[model samples]
Target: MPRFEELDVWKKAARLSADLYKSMAELKDFGFRDQITRAGLSIPSNIAEGYERATDKEIANFLNYAKGSAGELRTQIYIGMDIGYIEHETGKCWLIQAEEISKMLHGLIKSVRSRTS
Candidate 1:
């Protein structure tokens, strides 16, 4: 398998994390900003961590965590939109990206499981 950084999903997740940071950089609420950014960061971090692990099972497990973090980030994006912390179009774009990342993680997890089984 290619390195985690070479994976399309990982690349997208890393981009999303950077975008999130940039988008929220001016927000005044520290708690909300920190949580959202951390959740966004977790997606790529988990993917890299899993790929470096010893087995496909471990990789799949970490993918699951990445998926969970994607969901968390999506929810926070919605909250940010509702509270006017994020613009409507920006939130929509992030939400779409998060959903896509979750789907990618699901596919990767399935592939890993089949190979490990």
Candidate 2:
């Protein structure tokens, strides 16, 4: 198995999570900030957990979780933008990154599944 830290998708997801945390540091809306940050954090965390699993099936399952979290994060970003919590440009960039991360997770899951079959 490969190290999750070495994966580009993991790196990007981690960065995005960090960026979200930093960007939201000043926001007074604790509920919104907490939910968004938690969703952002889950993406990379799930990827790492998946990569650490012993079986290909487990890994693929975790990757699916990560992909789902990416979608969750993107949804929160959209809501944030709509509510004026997130700056339009910053939210737009995050949306793109989340989508790309989801794609990367999908590719990784396919690769793992191929190895199984």
| Best prediction by lDDT | 1
Name the regions of candidate 2 deviating beyond 4 angstroms.
Answer: none
RMSD of each: 0.5, 0.6
**Which residue pairs overlap in candidate 2's backbone?**
none
* lDDT tens readout by residue for model 1, 1-117: 889989999999999999999988998999999999999999999999999999999999999999999999999999999999999999999999999999999999999999977
Q: Which stretches of candidate 1 lie over 4 Å from their true place?
A: none
Cα misplacement distance, residue 25 of candidate 1 (Å)? 0.9
CA lDDT scores, all candidates in order: 0.96, 0.95
The CA root-mean-square deviation of candidate 1, after full C-alpha superposition on the true structure, stands at: 0.5
Whole-model alpha-carbon lDDT for candidate 1: 0.96
